[model samples]
Target: MRHFIAVSAIALAAGSAGAQEIAQADSDWYKAGQERIQAELAKTQNTNKARNVILFVADGNGVASNYMNRLYAGQMEGGMGDDYVQPQEAFPYLALVKTYNINAQTPDSAPTAGAMNTGVKQRFNLINLGENAIHGDCAKVSGNELTLFSELMTEAGKSVGAVTTARLTHATPAAVYAKTANRNWEDSVPEGCTAQADIATQMIDAMEAGTLDVALGGGARYFVPKGMGTPNGGTGHRPDDVNLIDRAKGLGIQFVHDKAGLDAAADNAPILGFWSDSHASYEADRPETEPSLADMTAKAIEALSTNENGFYLEIEAGRVDHANHATNAKRAMIDGKAFADAVALADEMTDDADTLIIVTADHEHAVAMNGYCGRGTPIDGLCFDVAKQGIEHSDELVLADDGKPFTVVGYLNGASSVMVKQDDGRFTAPDGRPEITQEQAQDLDYNQQVLIPKDSESHSGVDVALYAKGPWAHLFDGTIEQNVIFHVMNYATNAN
Candidate 1:
């Protein structure tokens, strides 16, 4: 019995010693891993320490659009010389991201942007909240609560800013700060929600909370009082309502309305610049009514870069989607180029090795650049004029050969069949007659007003491309889920 007890004690001591050795080995492995990470982090130049993160969102932009833009900018038409190759060619880090909503195969800006901002998949038409949240009721949602901007700036002590060619309260921008199930809560109230918070309320709250350092873009009417003429000569917000400009002032926000005002504002001060009452005009159609996307981006970087703690700025070129929906190829391409120009500017301004810059799209459009429209010969056999062809504005009406009165393009589902037009004023279909204007083709007696084409263009379901530069850019190598973007940004910014 004594021998047996001694044997048992010996075995227990041996087991305890082995356990202690294993624990020590694990501790050593952990220390080694941490040291390796620290060494890697130390090798990065302080200039590349990422004092600022700039995310440029080209709304509805896709791989096709990027290729198209490259073609246009390079003037690479018909195997032309590569003299026009832009600097985007050298972008080494690229990834493809999935962009589907929880409820829809072809996602809209609401949920797609929500996924990008909140790092969570959400239902269609919802912004910044999970699928189960009651529309416009932030109280119902649980578990999925961390917003990239809120998490980075509030918890991680980074500054946050947003700039867009669309309204600042629009889906893409709102996803960063506002929490609502329905994205359309700006103009209409959602079911089961008591507080119908507009873009103005979100902006004010962000400003008052002292997290949002810069807010620039359109949506002037939401900020102004009623009876006052908006920046676009439209009636402003309701009279007797709280003035957002004053509210911004109370929160120590430096409000600016025009380009000069924006330029004059101190870089250190928080800025609220609203250039238009609604969305800024497309880059192709801007006629004193809007600021270019590039301009907004440059201004935003200048304003946000002054922070010592680093800043997170979101710049959105939002009108490309609108043009794509209208099926206006020229407008879409031009707007996309304008957005790209903004990215170029950002690349130049934030070239510091530590600044992380990401360029991507929320979704893609159904627009495709098919093969060559013109014949082989440039002069004689070329039946279509590439430059002069104007698209039929609507698909409802058709133009007569004599250019006298409008007729029907064709009939589809009891609606007039619409045809897309090229730049040379030639229609796509062989039987499609030339109309006086594209709008004439669109104006038809139908159930829905076919804006560009009779049925309207749709968004593509393909994954979109993501381009990255600066610190940790190598991390964006493989195709990834949409939510992984948050993790990348979280890691890049060193957000805990």
Candidate 2:
């Protein structure tokens, strides 16, 4: 409700840019844009070797997601949102990364992240392991285990850490250390796969071995005994009777389950922390005491930066993917904004000359920016024809062929596909999906009308953007396989 009020006020303050008079493309103001591009072209690359690498991932944040999120952020700051430039956009090098898995054109989190973390693409549902492993098969995972970028950096004696808004055992973060045949095997091994390790077990094993120094984020459920909650009141979903928190203590890791604990943990000790039973709360609805995406990042950096050997850290805003799956635009964009804020904090904490910061997505979702609603229009608003095709001053809704007005944002497929017409002629989807809005099409509850109806929105095979700054960032200038990110980081860290 606060978001609705705040964002609604933001929209009112800026109103819509449709009211502004048009300027010719060849006008004097256009020269400023031309000059800016020339200045960018004249800049030289920083080819220095990197001492540290920080990778920020906004899960399911494709080009459209990034653009719309930036636009919304601008509005929140009281400007025409389109005018806002994201920190990632300031990166000197940018490129597209193809996100296909070995088996599917459109992949899920496991395989795509497999590429970024392991330097090789693999079959869907497989974690940091290689394609030699078959999904859901334990016996096939033997020599198929892939070497992680974190493993390489750690073997080089550098500090390594991972932070995420998702469960630390979630595919994206787990790819840094966990190798499993099934991504869903976070809490327990399957009935037949008990001989193999779960994601949580692999993470603890890695931490105990001293390869992963700072581990922060959620998934407390997977570390404790089933039928029990942590002493801090978190549910324990681990099938085993062993309490890994105590085990972590035995291994000299300072385990924390809340914000105060997180802040109090000294940078000298190895840390294993989680503030939620599963994934951290959505940014739109996070608890005050739960560490933010930026807080986790800042703390992880503070701890790891202590290593004279430098550090490798991966911070993932994984809730963006969850939001999109439920077709919640407000939550997704808010998570993206949270991600940008984290990047801003990283920029504050590290210098570009020695630290390489990369922002990218593992894969995309079935979402896009659609309909022409004029510049400065609220990105989540209904399409309006206030100034299209020479109509200079008419406050009219842009009608579809069936005479029903559509929205600026749309989806390729999702649960919000059907609209039940309301009393005021607005529409609403049932169940609110992950969250809800009273009005359909543009409200936070609106699902951005999809063409296909399914349980949830699906992933897309389309390429995602990779933006970088700092040493060897120039290597990101060309279109690349998603796995190439690993190569670039390895080369930048000189860990290859």
Candidate 3:
């Protein structure tokens, strides 16, 4: 076990203090770290049932992604790119979540979210369905459906809600209440499948029954009729012309569209804020009118924490996953910042003794930090081989055998594919892509070169990390299956 990370061990005597004084200060800090390790090791486990629980997911964030985002966050705070700490990283308990599906090595959001939210590992593309269900068969969904954690919490009289930067009907948020053979059944019911309800319908049904207390996110288009884009930039994607927004309003759900509407939401009733048409814009590209991820989280907590029976809230910064799929690091990093901000705000809002807060991810992406960089390297810049320079004590560029400098950030596969126009109007590449300059490599819009070029990046098969604090957080100390998250929440809140 890592006793403590020497994150604060830096140039302590840069200008005033002498080297000996710095050495003595380092020794004192090391002693303090040892004392802190013993204190943590001796802490008694708190077994009390929590009054509130919050699950914060940075959809596809992984270890490398966390490191890069920490650096970016630090740089944003006027510090070097290294040694930055995210609020999630400050959680007292940590564990690794193995994120494979029932049948595949790499899992998608539907099954991963199902595992974390339902206590059952499911197949890819299946939302809240057990392993007994086939991927695309609707008939098997009845017997194979799994009860989601939020549903169980609601049954136990706890208010339940899901907040995401993605659509309310997106996979992560949808898994909290949706049960379907296919995750894509968010807007359309397959032809002739009259028995199945779409995801948005499920949210309304749950709200009408007083189970869902807050449902805030994007995907306003799917709830309304077609050609309703003018209202909120939506395509009005519903084919049956059923205006679900009107239904929500009729059911007494506070149907909100913009920031003003969200701010004016009735705390006495359920708040259903559909902020955008599709997925909300990335943080760096968002409009001022749309509420931020942190904004929604704070509002949901303010609205839900009033219940006498407590609440179960799911907060997702879903655009991080979208930016990673698009292989846009700058956008992803900014979204990561937004996610961390939400976590920190939540941390401030609730006391660690009575509330159980868990921060985790559904899966990982194929991004990596490459090349040898110097200390304080700009995480968004090109990689430099600092070690290859001579002992002249001056910085020098280290080139590859091909005499090229690579970037600090790259993906295993993404939009970095190279294609040469063929003579017959097709595209093919006989040889691989040529080397690019540092300037070209570090551009914010540049798609980092990858080993395999894909239309969209793939999910990583690696295990993702989970961080936790508060009551029952020690339940996540060691490595655990992804589904264990649901069980831990169940046990912590006594929702069973």
Q: How many backbone clashes does candidate 3 have?
A: 1
Over the stretch 182-281, how does candidate 3's per-residue lDDT look in tens digits? 8888888788775568888888888888778899999888888777652586478888778888888898788888888888887767999887889987
Q: Candidates sorted by TM-score, descending order?
A: 3, 2, 1
Per residue, candidate 1 scores C-alpha lDDT tens digits across 1-496 of: 9999998777654643444555564576555755654555555323245667787788888776665555455432443212344444455578999988887888888788778776777787777775666655645655544455555565667778888888888888887777765676653344444544565676778878866778888788877778877655676763347677777888778888777777788888888888888887778667653457777788778877776677888888888777666655456667777887888898898765768888889888764433223322111011122233453122222223454333111112111224556679864546444443434323321121122444456777778999877877767868887777766776777732
Residue 78 error, candidate 1, Å: 13
Once fitted onto the true fold, the runs of candidate 3 whose alpha carbons sit more than 4 angstroms away are 1-39, 42-44, 387-395, 418-442
Better of 1 and 3 by TM-score: 3
Q: Give the TM-score of candidate 1.
A: 0.73
Model 2 lDDT at residue 370: 66
How would you encode candidate 2's per-residue C-alpha lDDT over 1-496 as one tens digit per residue? 9989997666545523322434554566665665675668687888777889998889999888888799889979977687789889887889999999999999898888878887888899888777678889888878777788888888888989999999999988988888899999987877777546888888889898777899998888888898887754866888778888788889989988878889999997798888888889898788888889999999999999999888899999999999999988888999999999999999999988889999999888988876666655667776666674562323666667656767667788887776544688765655433322325555565567776777789989888899999989888977899999998998888832
lDDT of 3 at 31: 58
Q: Write down the lDDT that model 2 would get.
A: 0.83
Candidate 2: worst 10 consecutive residues by lDDT?
Answer: 430-439
lDDT of 1 at 269: 80
